[model samples]
Target: MGILEKIGDIEREIARTQKNKATEHHLGLLKAKLAKFRAELLEPKSAGGAKGEGFDVMKSGDARVVMIGFPSVGKSTLLNKVTKTQSEAGAYEFTTLTCIPGKIDYNGAEIQLLDLPGIIEGAAQGKGRGRQVIAVARTADLILMMLDATKSRKQRTLLEAELEAVGLRINTRKPNIYFKIKKGGGISYNKTCNLTHLNERLVAQILQSYKIFNAEILIREDCTVDQFIDVVLGNRKYVKCLYCYNKVDEISLEEVDRLAHEPNTVVVSCEQNLNLDYLIEQIWYHLNLLRVYTKKRGEFPDFSDGLIMRNGATVEHVCHSIHRSLVENFKYALVWGTSTKHDPQRVGLAHTVDTEDVVQIVSK
Candidate 1:
């Protein structure tokens, strides 16, 4: 059978199989197999892989965010509203045939926003440029999953499944597991905390399925079999996602209130311009960016624009961000902010920086 047929068969078997101690191992293996087949399908044949064509757009700004939804679901409208760019919105399906790019400047950070073509059922199966669209999303720092307020909530589930099938884990953190493969040593399993979901033997079996014979596995947290498999696969993308329900003007206040209460969800009406600023604020917060101002030895700090860094960034990270050569030449950084114990404290490269911190690099 073909790859899709094989995947379908495995999926059917997984669905038919009951969930219990007796079936857990079987289900795990089947899920692994299914994931393998899906990967194979998404993998490009040539070394260069599939070209972006119309789907590929150059990434700009401090971070990239993509708008994903079914066609005519107001994704284009929302993009135009937020970024002040024209992205061809209509009342028909597939109004956007390619990726449309825009920018949202908030809090001194320029965020790139992309409006992509509608995703359909079987998108992960390469239906209607879905692979290309998802490829764009893989490069994104954040994914805005736009949904129609009038449509069934199941659409969100379907979109999520499509993204997951292609190795994108939304709003999920990476499993705290360390796995290393050695040539000679046999399987060594170490657990720092009590594992309620997985045991050593089952982990060994899963590792064996991947042809990992001599490896060391460290489990720092209580994770599931699927999470373990993800570590073994080692190519999954852990990204943050915001569920945006558009056309809220068409819905009732009760419905809007209900969706607002959902975690990581925003209710907005692009036509009515409802809650767009709040949405932008949430995006800024979730991006978790830090603005670090650089100062010279004998002059004042540059306050017009600050260097944007990700949260938990260190002084060394700032150095590297400025130039790769600066890391090697770096001596220490003087900081004046909440991250330092005292004002104008001299810190080393390992010192973590906080937002609005003033940094002055002292080179050797």
Candidate 2:
């Protein structure tokens, strides 16, 4: 049978198989096999494996945020409202046939917003050029999953399922599992905590299914078989996803309130221009970006221009952001911000910087 057919068969087998101690190893092995087939299915059709045209937009700005949802979900409307770039907006399906990029300046930082074509059901299965859409989504620092407030709840569910099927774990972290292959020694399995879902024998079975005869496995926490499969495949992306429910004006206040209360969710009406400012705020918040200002030895710091950096950025990062060769002659940095114990404190390259901090590089 073909790869898709094999995947379907394994999925069916896994679904029918009962979950219990008796069939745990079997289930784990089946999951590993399923993961392998899916990985192979995603392999490039050509040998070179280059990206197709129209999806090759250069990444710009301090951070990137991509909008993904069903057709006519107001992605284009939202993009046009926030940024000067005018994406084609319509009330019909598949209005956007390609990825359109726009830049929005917020808090003195330029953020790149992408309006991707609306994806359909079975997107992950290569339907409606979804592989291209998902390919672009993987490059995003954040995912803006737009949903129609008037549509059924399944819209969000289906969109999430497509993203998940392509190995995008939204609002989650990678599993803490250490695995290494060895040449001579046998399997060395160890764990710090009690694993309820996985045991030594099950791990061995799963490894053997992948032809991993001799390897070292360390389980840091109790994780599922699918998580283990993710570790083995090692191509999964863990990104922050904000669920944006648009067309809130078409829904009741109670329904809108319900969606607003959900974790990492925002309610907005693009047509009514409601809650767009708050949406931008949440975008910056989720990005966790910091702005650092630079000062000269005898001059005032330029308040209008600031260097954008991620949270936990060190003085060394600041130096690199200034220039590639700046670090060579770097003596030290005088930091004036909350990250330092005292204002204008002398710090080494290892010192971390806070938002809106004034940094002066003292060179030799």
How many clashes show up per model?
A: 0, 0
For this target, which candidate reaches the highest lDDT against the unseen true structure? Answer: 2
Looking at model 2, which ten-residue stretch has the lowest summed lDDT?
44-53
Off by over 4 Å in 2: 45-54
Alpha-carbon TM-score of each model against the true structure:
0.93, 0.95
Give per-residue CA lDDT, model 2, range 243-282, as digits (tens).
9999999989999999999999999999999999999999
lDDT of each: 0.90, 0.91
What lDDT score is found at residue 300 in candidate 2?
94
Return the TM-score for candidate 1, rounded to 2 decimals: 0.93
* Model 2: per-residue Cα lDDT at residue 236: 99
Give per-residue lDDT, candidate 2, residue 264.
97
